[model samples]
Structure formats: C-alpha cells, structure tokens
Target: MRSTTPRIDVVPAPTPAASLVFTTVLTHGPLTRIEISRRTALSSAAVTKAVRPLMAAGYLVEDADEEARPSLGRPATLVRVDGGRALFIGVKVTGDEIIAVLADLCCRIRVARHLPVTDRDPGAVLASISGLVQELLTEAEGFGVEVRGLGLAVSGDVDRAAGVVRYSPFLDWRDVPLVELASTVTGLPVTVDNDVRALTVAEQWFGAGAGISDFALVTVGAGIGCGLVVHGKVVSGAHGVAGEIGHLPIDPLGPPCHCGNTGCVEAIAGDAAIIRRVREATGAPVTDSAGALELAHQGDPGAREAYTRAGEAIGRAIGAVVNVLGPQRVIISGEGLAAYDLFAEQIRDAFTASAFGTAAQCDVMTRPLPFEEWARGAAATAIQSFIGIDTY
Candidate 1:
C-alpha cells in the first residue's frame, strides 16, 4: 500500500480548465461529467474538453460503470484523479526539529523522515534539510518517479509571494530566500509558506474545513497562530500577515510577548508564558512544556490556574475572530493539545461568555494533528504551486 518511491507518469502541465477539472475530481470524485459541470459551473462540453487532456496525460482516469446509465441512453463513467502521476516533498521546520514527508500526487504520505537541529542558524538547518531531501530522492528512485516540487513551512513573518522567510523567530533567520535555496539544493521547484497557513490549506482541501467556504485553524503551543480562509480563499493580507489573533491586545496587564508587546493574546496563552506563570505561582522549578503539563495534570493549583488563564485568553482571541469573520468553524490544534483537558472547560466557558450573539453559534472543534500532518500541509502547498493555483 505504501512505497518510498512511486511510478510517475509523464503528466503534461495542465491548462486552467484541466487544473480545475482535476481538482474537482480529486476532491469530489468519482464524478460524472454532469456532476463535474454542476460543481465547477462549467458546461458539460467544457468538462469533457478539459478532462480529455488530463486523461490523456494520465493525471485523470475514467472508471467504467456500464450498469449506471443516464436518462439520454448513454452510460456515464466516473472520473477520478490518478494518484501516481507525480510526487512531492513537504517539510515543516520547527525550532528544534524538521519533519519531512514524501507524498504522492494525492498528498498521501509515502515516507517520512525527522531530523533534529542542534543549531538554529539558517546554514545549519539547510544542511540538515538537504540531507533529508537526498534520502527521500533516493526513495523516489526506487519508484522511478521524479519529485516535482518541495514545500517548506516555517513560523513567523513570511513573505510567501517572494518565497522568503522575512523573519523566523524560532529559526533565528531573517530575509532568507528559502524557496530559491531549497530549489537549488534539491533541483525542484519550491514553495515557502507560513507554517500555520500551509496547515490551513491542507485542512481546507482534505481535513475538517473541506467544502466549507469559511473557517479558521488556531494552533496553540510554543506560539499561538491562526490561519483564516474566507470566501474560498486563505486571507494572506496585504503585508502577508493576516489572521494573527495572537498579537491582538486582550489584557493590558498581562505578561509581555516576544514581539515586544504587553498583554497580547500570545503573551498570556503561549507555552513560555504559561510556564513562566506556573513557575512563579508554584515555585516548582519546571523547565519545559512536559513538566508544566505534568504539574497541571497532578492538580498543582498554580499549574492549573496558569492553564485556566491561558484558556481564557485563547477563547477570547477565538471570539474576536468569530465576531469579525463569522467563519462556520474554528479548528483548535497543535502540540499544546496534550494538556487540553486541563483547560478545556475554561476555553468553553470564556468562548461562550465573550462571543457576540450568533458568533457563538459558530462551531468550534478541536482535532489533534501530529507534526506529520503539518508536513503534509507543506506538501499540499507544493501541489498548489505545481498546479499554478497558489494565491499566496
């Protein structure tokens, strides 16, 4: 069911209609021509025209369903994306580690590798990344597939249009042209995006936000990050920083944030903030996130209180997003969910208490995603880039 490398067909670069038809099938197939027309708002003739080239290129296949007949005396066959046409690589870079996955055209993971970084310098991280990509390339050789693209996802201010990392606090990098560097090193087209935004894209295409016109994914952990999709597009803002609920001023008297702002949502709800509060309130020399979660689970009053406050802050931030955008859902995720039980009640309470009117009716759900899922998001970004559908 899984292979490190896959046999890739020589799929021609798709035209605009071809791209649309292929995406429609990949998301909502095996669909008939009539159904594809209804979903994409193209005429049946246009759908047929678009699908023909994709089918010839081996990117789409028609499944025979002779038993199923249309009213016009012709049997309608179902069309679906061919998952083996190409391969891509997606990598999520965290402060201390890199998680990379080799994925097929369908964005399914074929192989994954993780590397730890002892240094945050850009050169050191790039070297580690190159080694990992080379390993995956060898894996690709076994399948006789060419890896078409690479997606690199990192946190902090990212200028995705320019394929640059403007400022990555976790990586201690500034103005690094990541896409060009990675492309040169790996010999493939590359896309660089904000980690949370890349994750949102994956969610929009295949996860909880699928078919929804509007939604938000809020990540709580070392950093509190939000990714917003509205009116069927992820809002990257004019300066490439939108949906940054973490910097919203929620409490004037709250602790200072690394962004040099006092009382920001992230200042009150981020991991470091919670750990600092726990240490001060409990005098328990807790040094890291695991220790903080352990103390909270053990019923330590200070640890519990810290999480309670963080939950309140995060809830209010989500409330702000809902009040403004009115998304149909808000997905809560990230490594921080390991301690979700400690603060779940507080999050619910604060959200209900502060959300304005019908905004409270917006569904809020938490789905835990591991690091590999984030890497898959990176792969999704690469797919978007390859298809020339990248809006950001």
Candidate 2:
C-alpha cells in the first residue's frame, strides 16, 4: 500500500539577487556581510537588502563577531546558512539501486538509505522511489524541520525546466513526467535533472570543481555521463542536451550504443559495455560488473584488455571535451573507478595522444564518489530549487 504523502510547508521565492547572495553565503560562509558583498560583487546595500528576508526567515543566521568591521560600517558579524532551517530529500536512481538521502538546508546528509532495484519500469521505479522517499520523510521527522523539496537524478537527456526526462537510455525511458509524478506521490516540490548534471552541482560547490569557473565532470559506471560547467554555470545547451560526451562517436566500427549510435564513448567504456567485452574476450559467463572486475583482478589478460580499451575510449572522450570547451579541469568519477588501476595508464596515454596543443595541459584527476554523494548532489539540486538557483 502507498503511504500518505505529507505536505511540505515553505515555497521559496526565486529572486535573482537573493538567490545569488544566498548561494554565495552557502559556498563560502560563515562570512561577514562585507565578505558576502565583496564575493558576490553586489553593492553593500544590495547585500544587506538581500540578507534581510533570508535572516527574517531564519535561513541565514549571524555568527559571533570575529573582528570589527571598521571599513563597512556594519556589525562585525559572520553570516552563515542556518542548516537547520529546513530539510530536503535527494534520490539517485541507478539501474541497480535507489539511493536516497535526507539532507539539511546546507545540503549535508543527515540520513541515507539504499534499496536494490529489481525492476526498471517507470511504475516500479516510482514505487521504489516512493518507498525510499517515505523512509527519508520519516527520518526528517526526528530533526524537527520541514522537508522542503525532493530532487530526482536520473541518467540521460533531462529537461530541467520542464521537469521531464526526455530520454534516459539506461532505463529505456522516454518523455517521463518525472517531477510531476514524483511530486504527486511525495507531496513535495520535485526537481528532476540528469544524474551527471545533478552531481556537477555538488562538485561545483563542494568538490574539486570549487572556485573553478570552467570544468567537466565525467562519470564512468553503468553509463559514461558528462556534465559541463562553462563560465561558472552548468551548461544545458539550448536543446537541454549539452555535454553528451558519452555519445561522442570515436569509432564508426565500434560497438552500438543504446542510443542507436555506433562507436559512441559509452558504447565502448560504459560498465555494461566493458562487461560485455570481458565476457566475449574471456568466454566467461559474467553476469554483472562485479564478476567482470573479479575476472580482471584474477589476472585474466582478456578481462584486463577489456578495461584497457574502455579507458582508451574514455580518454578520447575527455580529449574531445578539452579540445572543444577548454575547461580548466576534467574530473573523472563513478563506480567504475573501482577498477581504475587496470585502466589508469591507458586513459592517460590516450588522453595525451588525442588532446591538442595547450588543451593537453588541462588538469585531469579522478575522484571516487560513492552513490551516496550522487544522492547528495540530488539534494543539492533540491536546495538549488529552494533557493531559486535551479539554473543547474
């Protein structure tokens, strides 16, 4: 039986200056009003005005004075987001599992839960989502805070403005009204976006991408997903499908992708693809990515060779991103990193070979973010919507 959907109380107004001020405070606080003004480049008066409503609503709280503010002629008080002001829920639906987190206003995870996914149909996935959301909602009750919103992160071409999953190749979904359906069942405002894009939000604010204006986040797991942030903003292209690096056609003779394209990066390096290649190379009855990895770990030449090729494909994809966007950094992450040792050399070699000129100098690094962090990224999206900065 479906549980009753509890209603969330606050609906934040999406004001431009207030949103900017609030986010600046979020990423670089507890800081003084003067610091906020300087960082945001808003006039002191504008900062004060923007801080008013937020303070009044108990979202921004003034910290104790660290030093006197003689220059700004204001109280020497540090300001930081009151994380306990409200709470949110973030859900990351992978092909194998559903991960949910209950987070505070600051996007800190207070509680988390994981559930196996036995079915991939929209109805079954929604039911699984509802169950996890209900669990998180119950957990939120212990904090004595209102749960403000829910964020849903799935892989594929997602239309954030429309709250629709235009197409999720991993789940074989098309034109799913995810936000509306999720809101109907959860009774909270929902923000649905591409999983990689959602993770990029957390990366921009809290991970390696912090303070960097331009970078790319590439996830290598069940799928090869890329999220691009250009000029400090997550690029969503005019058609809601920017940064589809996973589908870059590196080889016309390569494997076919679920997107009906051949030789796409994902078709070569994605987890399923790697597993398939491993099975073909070793003639082993590998059923899952874990089994495939185990074979490679056991010193099976064929299995290791499969991962090496996957790395090469990924490196070429990264090279393309650098040549086109010229980002400051490229961060590689995802569950696939569990096998990084097997492919690290190939990735660097191929990237070096394919990158052109100064683009080759782009910093390339790997980060192992658990599925929970992806769920946290989902929560960050909910926080973004609550603060009216859903531009991501």
Residue 113 lDDT in candidate 2? 96
- Give TM-scores for every candidate, taking all chains together and pairing residue i with residue i: 0.94, 0.94
Error of 1 at 203 (Å): 0.7
Each candidate: RMSD: 3.7, 2.5
For residues 57-106, write the lDDT of model 2, one tens digit per residue.
88999877747657666647889999998999999998788999999988
lDDT by residue (tens digit), candidate 1, 135-248: 998898887887888889999999988989998877879999997777777777788899999999899888999889899999999889999999878989999989888889
Estimate the lDDT of model 2. 0.89
Give per-residue lDDT, candidate 1, residue 138.
88
Best by lDDT: 2
- After superposition on all CA atoms, how large is the RMSD of candidate 2? 2.5
